[model samples]
Target: MADLNSLLDDLAAESAELEALVAPLPPEQWARPTPAAGWTIAHQIGHLTWTDEVATLAATDARTGSTDFTELLTEAAPRIATFVDDAAALAAGAPVPELLQRWQDGRAVLAEALRAVPADAKVAWFGPPMRPGSMATARLMETWAHGQDVADALGIRREPTDRLRAVAHIGVRTRDFAYAVRELPPPADEFRVELTAPSGAQWSWGPADAAQRISGSALDFCLLVTQRRHPDDLALQATGKQAMEWLTIAQAFAGPPGTGREAGVFS
Candidate 1:
């Protein structure tokens, strides 16, 4: 596992990259529909900012228990929804330059709060208590996934990067997120994953001796688990019925099942 400080640095770098990608967008594009149904670029950014604030609360010992964490997400969802609605309303009449500045400001707040967390601390998250390192990893996953939405809306492409490893790690660790959404317990046995990393290297997860195997490119796996890309779009090869079953419902993000968007919409 990577050290917490290193993970924080990685998240910081990705956050900066995300800001750079969206900071200069013209106002008219804020209302452009992203691959996510009914969400525009503004909505995506709002959701990202809201999630960062929630992460900040988690890292600060603010969550009294799991109930508090759950409530936080529940409450924030509507607020973020409203934020998107309001932003889209403004986009109808507001100048593009002003909307872009607002995006920059919101992202700045999120970046500052993320940097404030202590690297060695443990914090409440959607699932198990996570160290700062894992929390930052989660943040990076969100940034990359949501940034993909923004990129797709703008019809732009971002080069694959080793940074995607953070997303893949979350996808594997949160296998239970998939199960939870289906109202099922996590599977009993571990599954092995062999994927090609962005740097043209191989990566593996789970027990080496496991009977089930899921192999593919790291980008495809990350996108698959995040529900940003479909398994069929990549060179995914699954062996063992259990591994294939898992792939049919994999989800890395915390939420109910998504609306099952088209595979590789971003690709």
Candidate 2:
């Protein structure tokens, strides 16, 4: 696992890259619809801004030993399924400049709060408690995933970067949660995941001798797990039945099962 400080730096860089992409867009372009149905570029950024605020609360609670975050989780439990979209829709109404600034400011505060968390403490989250490193990784994964929506809306192809390593790591770690959300049994054995990183370095997880395995470019794997692209459009290969099944339902983010992108949409 990466130390919290290094992960935080990467998170900042990833957020900056996405911010630059949207910062120069004219106000009218903010309404361009992304791959996510009914969600425009403004909605994408709005979602990120709202989530960062929630994350800030979690991090603040962890740092100060408070129950503010727990109270939020309790309050939202009944509406968890719709709360994410509801918040995004609400934030989407703000002027584009204001939405952009809120995301920028909220994430900065989240990063600072995360840094102050005690080394051994786990922060309360919608799904589970997370240490600062895990929280940062989750934030990075969401930022990159939402950024994909923004990029696709603008018809821009972003070059794959090493930052995707964080996204991929989350995808791998969330394998079980993906199954759990669907009320399906998780695979009994670990699967080896091997990918060729953009920098030409090899990244692998799980046992080298694991029976089930997935291998491909890190970029495709990230896109697949984030539900940004359908598996049929990617070159990822699965060696076992369960591994293949996982590809069909894999989701890196915490939520209900995502409908996922349509196959061949990007082809």
Best-fitting candidate, scored by TM-score: 2
Local distance difference test, each candidate: 0.73, 0.92
For residues 1-267, what per-residue lDDT tens digits would candidate 2 score against the true structure? 689999999999999999999999999999899999989999999999999998999888888878987898788889988888889999999999899889999989998999998989998887778888999999999999999999888889998889889999999999999999999999999999999999999999999999999999999999999999999999999999999999999999987898999998878
In angstroms, how far off is 171's CA in candidate 2? 0.6
RMSD of 1: 3.9
Clashes of 2: 0
What is the alpha-carbon lDDT of model 2 when measured against the actual structure?
Answer: 0.92
Writing each residue's lDDT as its tens digit, candidate 1 over 165-267 gives 8889888988877888799888798889988998998888999998989988898898788887766676688999878887878987765676555765544
Model 1, which residues run further than 4 Å from truth? Answer: 62-121, 264-267
In lDDT terms, which candidate is top?
A: 2
> Each prediction's TM-score against the native?
0.81, 0.98
- Candidate 2 wrongly placed segments (more than 4 Å): none
